[model samples]
Target chain A: MAKTTTPPDQNGTKTLSDQAYQRLRSDIIHGVLQPDEKLRVEHLRQEYGVGASPLREALSRLTADGFVTAEGQRGFLVAPMSEEDLADITRLRILLEKQALCQSIESGDDAWESQIVAAFYQLEKVEESTDRDPVEWEVRNHDFHEALIAGCTSKWLRRFYSILYDQHKRYRNIALSTEIPRDLHQEHEELRNAALERDQKRAGDAIEHHILRTAEITQRVLREESLQKKERA
Target chain B: MAKTTTPPDQNGTKTLSDQAYQRLRSDIIHGVLQPDEKLRVEHLRQEYGVGASPLREALSRLTADGFVTAEGQRGFLVAPMSEEDLADITRLRILLEKQALCQSIESGDDAWESQIVAAFYQLEKVEESTDRDPVEWEVRNHDFHEALIAGCTSKWLRRFYSILYDQHKRYRNIALSTEIPRDLHQEHEELRNAALERDQKRAGDAIEHHILRTAEITQRVLREESLQKKERA
Candidate 1:
């Protein structure tokens, strides 16, 4: 779980740009940087205590990842969020995730099984805690899902899945869900059980339903928030 | 079709970095830059006739897009190739392309249908001519496929689809197929008609088979080439 939160820091090899990349990625995903906010290089340098070159390097990389948008010479901004983008992310996540879940179930050995268990255990700890931070919960939840699919050997699939997950997380963070509409624990347990039993179809269906439902719940909340803002305006 | 080839260049606002990004992307996708080859900053500076800053920025962006690998202080390298990667790319492509095709079919307007027709016509023109450059055919083929899914309103899906397409193109260029087994023309026609007719299931199945068969053919050719090289060694 700890490993999943921040990638293992490659000591002696982490360049300044790499540091800035990690910082900016965490900041964006954790919602410290708001959606569609301008990411000026000078301001970021002052905020991150890093130099201009590395900050530019980080933002450029983020731009390529779709986490940040390059506004030509105008600079970069946090990738904007909307209902449409969230729905698209959810659709792609369901597609890629189900595929990954199926592959992991078929190809995962005992070691893979244990990783899933460990990840689930950590997530359960966070879920059961009443005082847990939303961001922490998100990280733990992310680790569990990632662990479930870690057995799949396709790097490209995993890469795309994680990118979607992060983008989705930025949305999830901004619009926090206080009351999940589904049997969240049961859903996770069923997914873990189906994968463990090597019931690939069941696992895929479980994940697909889970992801789709989450999207619906989040979108409803987002719509309400926007409506409230409109009323205030 | 032309709009699909390169994302309609932002009129007059294409920065030096943007130019470098496009140039390097084209070179890597078209196999002008070989895999695992070093991308020295100074050489690219001279070759691209751009300052080092923009070239570095371009490479960093490409690194995030997975076309190029950044090697810490060792600079960058063109992303390496492998059978595993091509298989993953093909699998993800089918998943994404099928979804996009379904969305396009469900929501596409008359304009979308016309674009598909026009793109197919251009591709046919190139396919029928024996004297055309393979690269030109590649461009037409890309546009035709892009036009097929032009109606999918999901920017994320389209963005991921294009990235996968570019990565797949890199593989296609690396292992040029001397003998294509699939009826390439028929596949394109089916894709075009399926979209126009709004036949979602057939479109999905057609694209799945098309992509899978292409993958098998490319993998076979790649394996043969590697084996011959080994034998020579």
Candidate 2:
């Protein structure tokens, strides 16, 4: 239900296609639409309050981003999640995150450091708050990590990292539960300290560990969920 | 004008936006539309013989792929090329490719090896033939390289690699000249052999050398071209 501001096109009116694209993308990412779910244009038209052309256009864009899979003439489906896909995404995440971290450390100035610190402080406050909203925490978490790589000047690298991050997010969303015990606060604080201190190696290693740990937990949760569904069936 | 055989939508007819997207993407990749050139929608509508709506949608999609840049309400422009951009692109290509090569080697079966052999044979034939059609060579060359990583099971890695390849292609296309000598045939042959033999390290190193050599040569040529233009100005 987050109303992400859509950047307008030339005529100053946001295109119906852009609106449809943003709505569908966020819905898919936030797990409102489940993985492997069919994305019928007619249903989407009624759901998103858009016409067929704009909906199809939006689905095409999502297909390119790996968020939706095209089923020949059958329309689109939300991209399926699997352990193999997660491994691919997380492994590349480590490499790109290291590259981003090292570049950020080398190129970041006082302003960049302060920005990162501010982001982390906000995230920590949200984490420690009694009335912590999940959506707010997710946004803060995304911002804190974005701040980490804000100094890497490669638009292409950042773009790929963001896409892969979203793909990974889809998996993590469905797997979220209270049972997995990770001291994410301690991990974030350590990562923030290393980053601020300009310790590239420590920061890089910490990110790899953090990502891999989360991937491991998510894989277990996903598998368990699948098993429970099967048992109920 | 290579027709890429556009995959049909639900209607069995390609959307106008898709047709526009492919044309613009190929034009940008082939350097027909120069980098940094403003992509005026009214002008493009006339140029591509498409409607305003579809053309804009296509531009938005290309913008996401980094082929075009959206300048807020000012609309889109062909993404500009620079030495720094090339460096960022080539460096990531090296890492992702190495990973792809290793994974492909481990996962590829005899079928994969045969596919590489077939692609390389066609490439070598095209290279040695009297009719040195640039477009044909370009397609064959793309296929040859794609075959190298065909065994890699990671869709995310392959997807990123493909995007970077297109971006790198834009640079190579603009930098193409009769000067700067590289024994591309020998390099391709060695790469093919390594891939068939399942020599991950050798294949990885070969790819690194091949990519770096091209990057270095392209950088020099681009600088020279810029200097000559400045002098003429």
Candidate 3:
């Protein structure tokens, strides 16, 4: 599990509920808790060294992020993923992401262009290395995409996009462990170049194609995984 | 406030938390709890005649909807709206809605087209009346737009778009009592005609322009309101 390095309580002023919320969010996002897993307040309290009150508070915040579902008095459970949900998530991601890329192309400055270059270089380095862990590569991949969209001016759009992106990432991790197609990298490179040239139409077109292709590939892998599980059953 | 019909209990068994969550969600969406209002769980518990546990669950769900903010142990508060958030929201709505409209036009069967026509007729009836309870108009407006996209096959895009629509509604209501342009109904009528014609490009273009124009008008009103408030302060 990835460890969180929350700043030390230099003033001894950290709230118990805040600590519990941070730990739980990290755990859920990092797949420490299985999807649709029941979350018992008492169990989490004991594990995180917090009390019931603070544990409840932490769980409430996570519920807001769609990481957990509240079953009224039955307690919270990690949200479940289904093939239907996967399709929907990918469709939404494509819609928002393409728009974000267009906005980034229209508004991005030289600094933003340089950041995209930097992110692409870092992503290439990580993709080329076989010795590094898969998890690290996944993190770097997320960072590169984030950097690409950093020039989008809409804060609310960015925030919602981040949530959708994280949800999609969780599903992507479960579906396949293989390297994404080289064509995906090539498409990104084209998209970066188009944006740098301030060709909004081409940038938008490249982003739409890039996103839809990933969805197509991932959906196929997910369908195959489901079929395999059914065969075993 | 729109009353939600509760599911009847077979054995006279009802959970306090379930009741609280439904009521609170309705209130938030219906504009009973104003935006940016501080939400004290203890106060809510007393107001709703529920215990702490159930009230906590209700708050948790609201937080997820971006309607409320959880401050850990300090308690929850309603999410704030500003001109900035409204503008970002409108921009996103234009992008997603246009895509959804285009998809619906390209793929809608006769039944889907009929539904859009019926929804437009109903909307026309509501718009004909001069009784300007913005709240009622708001609800009808949502039904009309949802009907427009009802033919779109992707559930995830619908879900994401609904969230954005709700947030946009909140901001719209905040600025509703202010002055708006008189030709809004004409624009809706034109959009309906475009959709009926099955001209995907024209329909998408009309919807995008309509959405952006509304957003621009509301944003101007909000900015003026802020200036007034500042002057009073």
Give candidate 2 misplaced runs (Cα > 4 Å).
A1-17, A40-55, A177-181, B1-16, B40-54, B129-131, B177-180
State residue B83's C-alpha deviation in candidate 1, in Å.
Answer: 1.7
Tell me the tens digit of each residue's lDDT in model 3 across B1-233. Answer: 76578555623436665577678766776668877788887788778887887687567656766777876357778887787788888887888888788888888889887887887777777778877666667777888898788778876567668888888766666776664636678888888888878888888889988888878777887888889989999
Encode model 1's per-residue lDDT on A66-171: one tens digit a residue: 9999886788999887898899899889988999988888889999999999988988888777786666777788889988998888888888888999888877
Collision count of model 3: 1
Q: In lDDT terms, how accurate is model 3?
A: 0.76
- Number of the predicted model whose DockQ against the real structure is largest: 1
On a 0 to 1 TM-score scale, where does candidate 3 land against the true structure? 0.83
Among these predicted structures, which one has the highest TM-score? 1
**Candidate 2 lDDT tens digits, B50-128:** 8887787687678778899876446789998888999999999998888898899999998888889999999999889
State the weakest 10-residue window (summed lDDT) of model 3 chain A. A175-184
Q: How should the candidates be ordered by lDDT, best one leading?
A: 1, 2, 3
Q: Would you list the rank order by DockQ, best first?
A: 1, 3, 2
User: C-alpha displacement of B116 in model 2, angstroms?
Assistant: 2.9
Report the poorest 10 consecutive residues by lDDT, candidate 1 chain A: A1-10
The CAPRI category of model 1 is: medium
